[model samples]
Target: MTLRACGLIIFRKLHEVSAAAVGDNIEYLLLQTSYGTHHWTPPKGHVDPGEDDLQTALRETQEEAGLDASQFTILEGFKKELNYTVKGKPKTVIYWLAKMKDNSAEIRLSSEHQAFRWLALNEACKLAGYKDMQTTFREAQQFLCSQA
Candidate 1:
């Protein structure tokens, strides 16, 4: 059985700069897990019983990253899903695009993560460590660029 989950691919437009400079100005959010391999990921977790996929994404974002839905402009018409296996168990993760309304919102982490970062795409991909997640980041970047 697959471990199902969902999350957001959140970015800040860097109000101090322009979109042409987004390659340098954009920052992707990555959280470092406190458990297992201490893998880095976007804010996400296992789906709770009876929760809808989008609801699970929002709830996990709030619980894991201390950012509420009002703090972000959840982009419409963009979604990505990843399927993979962990420890021989299949897992599926859904992601959506969002732009932080407060570009300077301070992230407060829960016990699930040890650290967080606002990284550029390349650095984010390198730190993300897993191929699927790397592709997710790329797709998110493409989505945001299209929105620009």
Candidate 2:
């Protein structure tokens, strides 16, 4: 059986930045896991039985990053699914792009993650350290820029 997970690629747009420079002003939220390789990624977790994908994404985002549904707006038409293998098991992760309503909102981390950072696309890609994840960040940046 494939391991399924869901999460949100949460980001914040800096105020006062012009639309032409929107990409530079956007920042993505990444969390450093406390376990395993201590790798950095968006907040995600295995889906609980009986939970739908979006529900799991919302629940995990709240549980892992302390940002509830009310704190961010989910951007429609930007969901991304990634397929990869972990420990010889097939895994699939679904991610939706969300924009933070309040850029200054505090991020309270759960024990699962040791640290968190809001980084630009390049820095986020570096910390993420996965080709697929880096591609996702680039796609997201382009999507946001197109909307701007």
Candidate 1: segments with Cα more than 4 A from true spot? 16-19
lDDT assessment of candidate 2: 0.96
Give the clashing pairs for model 1: none
Clash-forming residue pairs, model 2: none
Q: For residues 82-101, what per-residue lDDT tens digits would candidate 1 score against the true structure?
A: 99987899999999888898
TM-score of each: 0.94, 0.98
Listed per model in order, the count of residue pairs whose N, CA or C atoms clash below 3 Å is 0, 0
Cα lDDT, model 2, residue 137 = 95
lDDT of 2 by residue, 27-118 (tens): 99999999999999998999999999999999999999999999999998899999999999999999999999999999999999999999
Instruction: Tell me the whole-model lDDT of each prediction, alpha carbons only.
Output: 0.88, 0.96
Among all candidates shown, the one with the greatest TM-score:
2
Model 2 earns a TM-score of 0.98
